[model samples]
Structures are given as C-alpha cells and as structure tokens.
Target: MFLAWNEIKRNKLKFSLIIGVLVMISYLLFLLSGLASGLMNMNREGIDKWQADAIVLNKDANQTVEQSLFNKEDVSNSLKKQTTLKQSGVIISNGTHEENALLFGVTDKSFLVPKMIEGKKFHKDNEVIADESLKDKGFKLGDKLSLSQSDEKLKIVGFSESAKYNASPVLFSNNNTIQKLNPSLSSDKTNAVVVKDANWQKKSLPNNLEAIKIENFIKNLPGYQAQNLTLNFMIIFLLVISATVIGIFLYVITLQKTNLFGVLKAQGFTNGYLAKVVLSQTFIIALIGTLIGLILTIITSAFLPSVVPIKFSIVTLTIYGVVLIAVSLIGSLFSILTIRKVDPLKAIG
Candidate 1:
C-alpha cells in the first residue's frame, strides 16, 4: 500500500489526469440525471402532490386524462365510496393576459387542489388557484385571466408553487368555471374522478369506469409512460458512459504500472495486498469526484425555480452514490488482473 501511494505521489501529473477524466464523466452523469428527473417532475409533480389513493377514468379513454370524461351524475352513481371530481385540459395562449396553461377543474371535494402558498382556496364565483410562475405573465389575485382559445375568464384567488403537468403550470378552478368557458363540455361531467379508498378494484367499479391506483393511473396518462421511459433511458446511458470512461482510464493506469508491480512482487508484496492498494486508490478518487459533482448539481439547482421541475430526493442520491461506487469498483478490478500477471522473475533481471 505504501509503495502504491508513493507511486501515485511520484506520478502526480498522470494520477491527476486520470482523476480529472473521472471528474468530468461524473459531472456529466450527475447533470444528465438531474435533467431526466426534472423532466419527469415537470410532467407529474401535480399528480404526485394529490395524495389520492386511486384515479378513475373511462375505460375507452386509453391512458389519457384529457380524453376521460364522467358527468357529475355518472361519478356520483359510480361512487360506492369516497370520490371527488377532477377536470384537466391544456391552456392555449392567445393574445392579452390570456396565456397558455393547463387547467384542472375540480369540485370543492377534490384532493387535487393545492393548499395555498398565499391566500385561500376556491370559494366564491370566478375564484381560481393559480401557479405562482403565472403572476409575471399578467395574472394576479383578484384579477381576471382568460383561458386562451375560449372567451370566458376566471378570477385568480390564490397562488401555489409548481402545480404543473406535462411541463405546463396548472390552474385550479371549479367545474362550473370551466363549463362557462368550454360550452362544448358535458353540462354535468368532469374529466376524471379520484378516490382515496383502499378497497377499489377494477372489476368492482361500475361499467365503463376503470379504477387504478394513483401511481398506476399516472402511468396511464397519455404520453406519461413514454416520456418517462425516454428520459430514464438517457440517464442510464449517461451513467454507462461514465462507467466505461472511468474503467478505461483506470485500466490504462494499471497497465503502465505493470513493471513496477513486478518489482513490488519481487520485494515480497503479495498480489492481494497490491490489489487492495489499487482498489483503495480508485475508490478515493471516485469519492472525491462524485462529491464535487453532486455539490455542483445542488448549487445549480438552487437557482432554478420550482417551475423548472427538477427535484433531488434522498432516495435518488442514495441510488446514484451506490451505482457510481459500484462502477468505480468494477473499474478497479482491472488493476487486480494486472497485479496477478506480475512476474517477480522478470523484475529480478
């Protein structure tokens, strides 16, 4: 181990170059991971906050919250237990204060409505809870904002953070509010229904209504699964690339030190001890690189708003750390093979 440390210290430039490559790869992996997770959050953050146990949609809707529609009466009749009305649609931008947004029309009983970051929830006529990011877009509490592609206006009553789906800020209002804007909408129905009961099963649901756990229901949302899969693939690809690069770098380092390892073997050092030395070095370098990259990610994320949709949970960090270390350890294994190949007789020459 002392010999390995001295070798590394003596070849500072070479060791530094190897560590530098690892750092760059680590940084790229971390950045890509953040972007992928961010994109997913932008698409599903609102639903995640709903706290609903189940979501009900029309069986024929084929994984689209937008396509599912159930009248207030249909939902009422379908409800064998606790349930709430939920309406959702994209907001298209026209001219004026009317901008593009995603609308979520819910009844007073809906759990999807976010708790206020400022004022109150929907109560009186024209009342709406809006995303805080929309305030700069010419919306304010007590001011009227029109939904684009429609002539009707809803009054903003409060503000919330993030509150988005499919990368658009979400606005919450009552079904009556949406009815006034979209006359073509069913006079009595909602986009979907969410339930908190645990006993819900698909076969037990009323005909034409499909019951799904909230997580499963989100997967059933149009484009949700595809988008998530694509982003996840990108993240996985980046991690793989990082591992390959680090492994190649370590392998080259090990190859260059083969003769030195032969000399060490001649001096009575066992292959096992030499392997530990190389493995320890690889781990130390990887740990430093990962820590630095993660710190940078957090700093960059701090400047971004909730609307940006990037979130790093403890679980994500733990998994990332585990994967990175595992990759580094794999890279270190190359040196072990090189250590085994050392011929003490060749060094005696």
Candidate 2:
C-alpha cells in the first residue's frame, strides 16, 4: 500500500487522468440507472402503491389490466378477503390542455389508494385525487378538470406523491364517476381486483379470471418489459466496457513500470507484495472515481428538469459503486500477472 501510494504521489497527473475517465464513465452509468429506475416507477407506481400481493384480471384479456373486466359479483364470488376492485382507463383532458392521463376508479376506503400528500381523499362524486406530477401541468387542489370524452368535470380534491401509471399521472375517482365518464363500461365492472392474501395459484379461480403476481403484472404493462430489458442490457454493456477500459489502462501502466517491478523483485520483494501494491492502487483509484461520480450524479439529479424523470436510491448507487470497484480490482489482476512475470535480471541489464 505504501508503494502504491508513493507511486501515485510521484505520478499524480497520469493517475488523475485515469481517475477522471473513470469518473465520467461511472457518472454516465449512474445517470442511466437513475433514469431506468424512474421510468419503471412511472410505469408502475400506482400499482406499487396498492401494496397488494396479487392482481386478478380476465384471462381472456391476455394479462392486460385495461382489457380485463370484472364486476362486484365476480370479486365477491371468486376473490378472497382483503380484495379491492379498481377500474382503470386512459382518458384525455379537454381542449388545448389535452394530455393523456390514467384514471383509476377506486373505493374511497380501499387499501389500493395512495396516501394523500396534500388535501384529503375523495369524499364526493366527481372528486378526484391526482399524482403530484400533475401539478406541473397547472393542476392544483380544488381545480376542475374536464375529460375529453365526457362532459363531466372532475374536481381535484387531493394530490399524492409517485402515483403514476404507464408514464402518465394517475387520478383516483369514485367508481360512480368513472362509470359516468365511460357509459360503455358496466356500473359493476372494474378493470381488475387487487388481492391481499391466500395463495392465488392454489385457490380455484373463476372461469375467466387469472391471478398474477404483482411483479409479473408490472411486467405486462405496455413497453415496460421491453424497455427494462433494453436498458438493463445497455447497463450491462457499459459495465463490461468500463472493465475493459480499466484493464487496458492498468496493463499499460504496468508495462511502463516493468523495469521498476524487476528491480523490486531483485531487492527481494515477493510477487504477492507487488500484486498487493497493484490491487491497492486500483482500489484507491476506483474509490476516488466512484465517489466523484456519485457526487456528480447526486448534483445532476438535483438540478435535472422536471421533464426528465430521474430517481436516485442510495442503496442502488452503493451497489453499483461496489460492483464498479470489484470490476476495477478484477481489471488490476492483469497487472498482478505482469508483476509475477518480471525477471529480476532484466532491471540489472
């Protein structure tokens, strides 16, 4: 470790340049990871807020909540206790302020509803609770929003954090209001039912209904599965590229110090000691780079435009940083092998 520190102190510029490169790459990786997590939350936060174990949908709907239809009778007859039925649909706002929004028709006291961050839950017909993201679109508590398809105006009664569905801000309304908005939908029918207990797989389901785990249900959301897979592949690809870059950098650095390594061997330094120096140097570099990257990521996330959804979790960042250091250490193994191969006589000649 002393040897590694002395070497780094002697060649500060070279090591600093490598550290800068690592910082940039790690920052990019963390940024992408944050975006991926934010997108996932946007896609499923509404469902996640439900905190339900299983979701029941019409099997004929092919695992899509919007296409599924079940009524109170179906829930009472087929679903176990602690179930909440919710109707969901995509509706456009009226006029020039037009935007697609996910409308969730939920019972006032249902566990499926998100806790209000501001104001109170819906208590009257046409009253609604919306995601905080809607605030960016000029929506506020007590504001009246008109649906494009229906003349009925909804009064925003509350706002909640992180209540989004399929990349659209979610609004919770009374089942009666949703039925009024969409006359085609039966008064008793809901898009899906959230089940809390009982093994859905073990229990017999109704003829047309299927129970899917919450994770699987989230995957079935439009573009969710594909988007996650693509982003995850990109993250993996970037990690591999980062490892290669580190490996090549360390290998080149080791090559430049070949004579020094040979002289150290001639002075009775063990191969294990030299290997330790190289790994210690790698660890120091990785730690510094990762810290810089993390700080930059946090700053960037703080200043990012609301238009760009980016979620940062400390746990996720820590995991990524650890993995990065591990990869960098693996990359340094090449230097260790080069150290082992250094011939003591080569330095004397």
TM, every model? 0.88, 0.93
Q: Supply the global lDDT for candidate 1.
A: 0.71
Per-residue lDDT of model 1, residues 44-110, tens digit only: 7888887777777888887567777766465565454554554556463324555567777676766
Q: lDDT winner among the candidates?
A: 2
lDDT scores in order: 0.71, 0.82
Per-candidate clash tally: 2, 0
**RMSD in angstroms, all models?**
2.7, 2.0
147-199 per-residue lDDT for model 2 (tens digits): 76777888888998867888888888888888787664566677777887656
Give lDDT: candidate 1, residue 32. Answer: 65
